[model samples]
Target chain A: MGVTGRAKRGKTEGPILKKCSTGIKGLDEITGGGLPQGRPTLVCGGTGCGKTLLAMEFLLRGALNYGEPGVFMSFEEKPDELVQNYASLGFDLEGLVAQHRLVLEYVYIERSEIEETGEYDLEALFIRLGHAIDSIGAKRVVLDTVEALFSGFSNESILRAELRRLFRFLKSKGVTAIITGEQGERTLTRYGLEEYVADCVIFLNHTVSDQIATRHLRIIKYRGSSHGTNEYPFLIDQQGFSVMPITSLGLDHPAFTERISTGIPRLDTMLGGEGYFRGSSILVSGTAGTGKSSMAAHFVDGACSRGERCLYFAFEESQNQIIRNMRSIGIDLEQWVKKGLLRFHNTRPSLYGLEMHLVALHKEVERFDPAVVVVDPISNLVTAAAPKEVKAMLSRLIDYLKLKRITAFCTDLTSAGGGILEQTEVGVSSLMDAWLLLQNIEGSGERNRGLYILKARGIAHSNQIREFFLTDRGIALRDVYVGPGGVLTGTARIAQEARDAAASTLHRQEIERKQRELERKKKTVDAQIIALKTEYELEREELQQAVAQERLRDDVVMKESMEMARARQADAVPTTAGGKQGRGGRKR
Target chain B: MIAAEGKRVHNGDGEQWILRLYVAGQTPKCLTAFANLKKICEEHLAGQYRIEIIDLLVHPELAKGDQILALPTLVRKLPEPVKKIIGDLSNTEKVLVGLDIRPFK
Candidate 1:
């Protein structure tokens, strides 16, 4: 069939691109609906950059989420070690094994005792892999750091040949394989295996820039597939590795036709219409005490009031603390919690790894299946991980929520003088779909809160900053009244203005006083300059006289030497007479 | 078990006997097949019994090994030899009857 005609025919036959869901939250979006099915993908990374975690998560998600059996061939860690390592993340590998959904094989190659008998080949290894794959009929297989085969044999040619054979075998067997390679400096792998035998190559990097270490993943190459080319920041928390491929979703996903309220009518009015679109991510960034969390809670209450489930993940406050604080502002989340429409996931920032946090979030989201998810203060999460990791996690979380059509609202705490759109740690400001900025503005001798919509994707939002207030009733928005300075230059700017006024007054007084002192000092300096110039001229004349004296001394010395030589020659006149006598004696 | 046949031949019984031996792999018990057959021929059968030795290791595709599921098993086939013996063929009398070589009364 002609290519275009075949493609047109394939449209009626459904998608020919077979997909294997990565089981990771945002990874599927970056991979264009996961890794290409029945092909080996090379996942290469440095130690602890989460190659193993990603592999395990792939297997776990395959078994648990997709009902596909998986096999894990570990070269360094045993099955028990993997099980124990993933226990905290709540991935029960052993349970999966017992359920016949997963299998783990440890391939140990002892370099000390390995004697090459000239008759052995990699056929035994292949046999064992085949046996494991057949035993469970695994559709997904992960060989964690298969480069250990090189440790037992110094023959690079053999290792390369065998690995090529292995990849071909896996491909022929129609298993989606992930062979992890240890990342090397300046290269994807030690032996550059990524260049040879694989259909895809993914590079994982754990870089520490500005003292904040973050994990990032990049899809270097994937044959016959279109993938996101962005370097996705990933988090390794208690859950596992979650790549945040934010803003990479196609517009083909179903959109909500309904508009939801923001719980507070005045705040809703500030949204230029009524609330945000369902499945949209709302980022609320502000300095401390700007009522960002309170605004987020207002949205959560709005969702709960409508009988929709809302999940609140608080990184900055405990459930009781949030409830108590919000109660003073008339947001009683306890009632929603009692009605089973609201759930709170409060965790300390240092409690787990970034991937673990992603896992926890995944589990909570899966269990609750809330219509709205709120993360109060995503900035605290940034403290636990790098900016890239936080962005990656947020991307995954956002993608997961978008897939489920859940509206997500997250609050980020920014420094007092920082811009609303600038991210402090990893600079991931471009990833947010909708950004809201809250500030404490100084008006009429008191600090009044202000709100502004910085950016909202796919929707028109007001660019004007609105004056807002938080009271016992709830959050209220008012019309922004611009004064001498622009609106939204909040209390810090006022404080700076006041400080500048005082400093300017003091500066005028000080400058006058300093002007008087400078007049006196200048008079003294002028006198000194005059005296110094006079002394400099006198010193110059003295130096000129000294040079003349030295020249005269040199001339006198030269004259004395010349005169002495002349006197010596005159004194040697008897010697000339002796010479004449010797000459006459020689002639005789 | 019934006593089916009794035969005694000093020089030749004019009958060929088929024998089979089962073994797991190359082990001591698997190696003693030739020696045991030689002793049985020199002492009892002389030129009467024809013995065939089978190594289960090389010919695992053969079904006789799994049918008995015994290692180092010997089965006498001819000269009315209807009995089977397991183990290393150490006991001579049991093996003699196992090959239908008991003395006639």
Candidate 2:
């Protein structure tokens, strides 16, 4: 029982206290693994705050779940009434009694019946509790509303001393115990039983705000162990009491490097080449009728197509309503629902408080163990809870899903505004790994849906605002870059594209006319060149013929002169033997 | 409680007062409370009251029906509005005022 080193940050990870699980949801975690093992813990609350139920569940869970028999000394309720009350929670108290594993003894302490004849200690109570424990070999005990015995007292000191002795006796018996007390006007308990059972003190409070009754539990103090020091919301349903502790526990969840498809292929294109990171949280913030639910349905459809289990939590629409609405957009969730691969938990936010919603969602997610979870419009939770509560719930939920490596998509509904990325109620943008903003682009006499990725961790995403139209096949992203600065969408984009096509066609026709004129000029040039070459060839041929004729005339003239001069020299010189022979041959 | 009617109408017109004394196993305080209640009734409503004593030790379930948290309590059952006087009825003046009993005027 001495001081330890480095206990401030609670780094000593082994069993710090010999603890046992309360078997109450989230209570063990808040209690640093449950109430101290063999010590009595005081449970005090006002009337009808479920003090008895909490104590009874502790004993019952000890008996049934941990194989630890327990004895219940009810100062208020009878054994039969207890059995009846717990029967609804599926606790078979009678069966345990019949087996002699659980002993439920109702000690009637009538105030007016017994006069304090003398100084009487609660030694008789210790005897009865001891006998019950020995009879059942019990390891746990409960004294419900120990303050009931105080009514018959005339002296406060005697009552206080007896109460102190009773706790000491119970502790000496070496059995983990629970003692319930009614809340005082301003004190911890009616009799200050807290001072007696100082090992652990759990306080249950019932508060009504805004016409809603919310039950909360807090561990006022627990000695020798570090406990969660915050008020946690608890619910007492047919299964009995369950506490919800929205704790972060220092953010120790594993991360994944894998990617998953975002349903719409074009949306996937916007999110790098693959899609969102596996086990990452995505926020799709949008205004009314901005196709947020449709996007969620498409995500579910994509998950189902991959044969991964998916759960969709819808706050605004019913299961059949969403199924029918998605059918129009070519995303069929009904078939997956039938196939048992998809589950829809549709509930109204006003039906329960935010903590209850968180508890219900936690239960379903644990039960279904889905690979992907989609919450359509988490703004309902934001609307139903305070800002701090919503943030805490979101952080815890994100941590839980990250631990399970589940891809979660949450849609936040922003008010109808002129710009995207408007201030949301929960302000959970920092908790998300990827965020997509969907907006209504109302201009040029039409309302068009625009989508853009605000940020995606570990992936390079498109910075362009994609104008997507929901078609019968699915969502189709249009080529919206009309020009360097003009970003058109919807019908406006279609008109602008058509006009651009006409202008480009006109430009193309002018280029074609110039090409045709160049071809005609080239044809005329070729025809003229051919005519000049033909004329040149004809003239060259005449010149060559003239030269040949001139040569022949010169020869003939020379021959005539020679013939005249040499008529007698017939012979003339010129006509030698070869010439004469040639003349003769020509004459012949 | 009457079965045929949705609500029971208590008879408050000059009727005898029906009272119950809850005790535990013949204790001294139980005897004292019984004696005190009878003395008061005889003095104020002589021959016009009836007293029933219930030992919680023998029948503890009866305590639940009466919402009895303290022992030796005096319950004025049938005087229109039921009244409870806790403790051993030691204060006669307080018990008379709690039971709303006046002398025959």
Candidate 3:
């Protein structure tokens, strides 16, 4: 009796914010660290976009990962069929049920068999759901496509009213819920139920363009919190749907305190004093056929030689092709691949959406835990996405790499005649820590390749454009050579050399022409100087005559002043006394 | 054993008996009856009698399996079929009639 009273008090307190961990990878991030505890999140999507899978993953992960009991109310799928569908994904639904941690209720309603029983008020459904949830103490609830009730009943008004009431009832009871709805061709939800009664709405889209299907999920609205707004592409496989948030990681990753070599001595010299920080991003841009792949291969081999894992994602070459090609250049990728230190994921750039490629990259990176990640040519990825999308994906990739403290090397293929210094395909060149530009310069009737360090963020890098050659010994960089012209590319350097020679010949002709013009100007100045000197002497003689006339007038004035001064001295005595008396009277 | 007016005979040898149970109709109150007697008879007397099921609507004289105080009654007549049960055979003694038990003696 004592315990009974306390238990009653607990029940009246209602459900606290019950949280269900969505088993979906990266989904929790978009959900502001999972759906509001005990509140229903409406998941609406078109057919085959993994709406049900998402709901099931939420329930499964709740039971498996978080020790929270769950209830799945399926109106569309039978319990057995639902279990079978998730079996391939390694979710043991039956085991969870047997252990009493999960409950699944299959509500079968045949519309034809149903009579106009106005007395039925979904009381039976409430009883069934209530029993299932209470029986398992379920903290998570999933109503899989509850819209089936609309099919069973003809009255839309009653269905809407009841659905709202049901959501309110579940909320009042305090169960964290996920309610899935079908998506209409033009509407966010088939029944538009998602527009009402739910606290959150997520839209799942399966878009096919150019014969490639990609699944994208966007949080349409989340009340009381902030979430990522971009349409993040996800993958549906044996492990269920995994949402790859294109910008989940921000730019505030911890900088690596230690430095690591780039595996090439010359390349390392270009990166600061010796090497780059372990987790920094390196951008290598060049025109076609400038050995970008070779540089990446060298990095991969470098990481492998240090007994560290390296992941190479070659968008334009197969693993075997890359390994074989690199072997000829003395970069033995095959040996590293055999040692399990090197993992190669080579696929076409157009194989999937930008987000799908990112998800695949993320999955491999997570599984391998590699020290370095090499994208042979990230430029090819731009073709599959818009410039903005490519930027978002690359930002996410770089952020995730920094979080794992993994060095990332990305190669970009610039177009010919576009100049040596070109922006990256995604416009993320500013985000890179070290940027390297490779070009083919033509010099002395031959094309020589040059590599230069554009910017290294945190360290001093070699500014010299060093001459590099792909020989039998691998990538060897010759010392900085100051040739006739500036740094060279294969054909451009030779063209510049010829242009410089022609410029020198034209300079000599111009000097001789200037000397002849100077001689003519000097003779003209001599004649003008003699004419000006004669005019100067005549002007001086006229100025002297004027000066003599003014001097004669000054002599007559001085003689008159001397006679006046002698008369003033004879009357000086009496004048001085009179002047003193006048001064005293004026003062009084 | 002699046969006289109202005389009865007791035989040590097990012999087959004929019994009948009656009911007014398939009313809810009268439905428990035939099943009750058949179950008792099968358990006590297996392979001993050929039970005849009779309805009074067809033959009123064979208000058998017991005395007819209610719609459902029972009467036994073989081995002199023995006695009759009345009032829907709600009593156990009235059901012993088909087993040849004389409660009056």
| Candidate with best TM-score | 2
Choose the strongest candidate by DockQ: 2
lDDT score, residue A336, model 1? 97
What lDDT does candidate 1 reach at residue A369? 90
lDDT of 1 by residue, A1-588 (tens): 599998887775876668899879778978888988998999998888889889889988998998889999888998789999999899888999999999888776555433231112354456567767877899999998788888866556766787888888999889998889998788889878886655789989887644556678899998767888878778876667677665585445677756678787865665667767777778888888989889988998888988999999998788999999999998899999999999999998767666567768878998999999998878888767766667777776777787789888888888876554355344545656778888777655667788877877766667777877677888877676565655534464556567779999999999999999999999999999999999999999999999899768756765665577677775544434554565567547
TM-score of chain B of each: 0.70, 0.81, 0.59
Model 1 TM-score on a 0 to 1 scale: 0.57
Selected candidate, larger DockQ, 1 vs 2: 2
**Best-first order by DockQ:** 2, 3, 1
Identify the superior model by DockQ, candidate 1 or candidate 3: 3
Give the per-residue lDDT digits (tens) of candidate 2, residues A1-588.
Answer: 234555643545755668868798789989878889889999999999989999999999998889999999887788899999899999999999998879997877655444333223343455566667877898899999888787755667867887787788888888899999999998989888888999999999988765556788999989988888888888887778888776725577777889999998888888888999999999999898888888888889999999999989989999999988889989888899999999999998878877778778888999999999998888888666677777877877888888889999999988775464555558888999999988887767888888988899998999988888888777777656545545677778887888889999999999999999999999999999999999999999999999899768766865886677677665436455645665567547
- lDDT of candidates 1 onward, in order: 0.75, 0.81, 0.75
lDDT of 3 by residue, B1-105 (tens): 113211332332344566665554454434566666677666655455556665554444333113232244455666562454433344445455324442433
Q: Between prediction 2 and prediction 3, which has the larger DockQ?
A: 2
Model 2 regions more than 4 Å off? A1-16, A248-250, A382-384, A418-421, A482-487, A502-588, B1-105
Which residue runs of candidate 1 sit more than 4 Å off their true CA positions? A1-29, A32-39, A50-108, A114-146, A169-176, A207-214, A233-244, A251-257, A267-285, A350-359, A386-403, A417-437, A443-445, A450-470, A475-588, B1-105
Looking at model 1, residue A223 earns an lDDT score of: 78
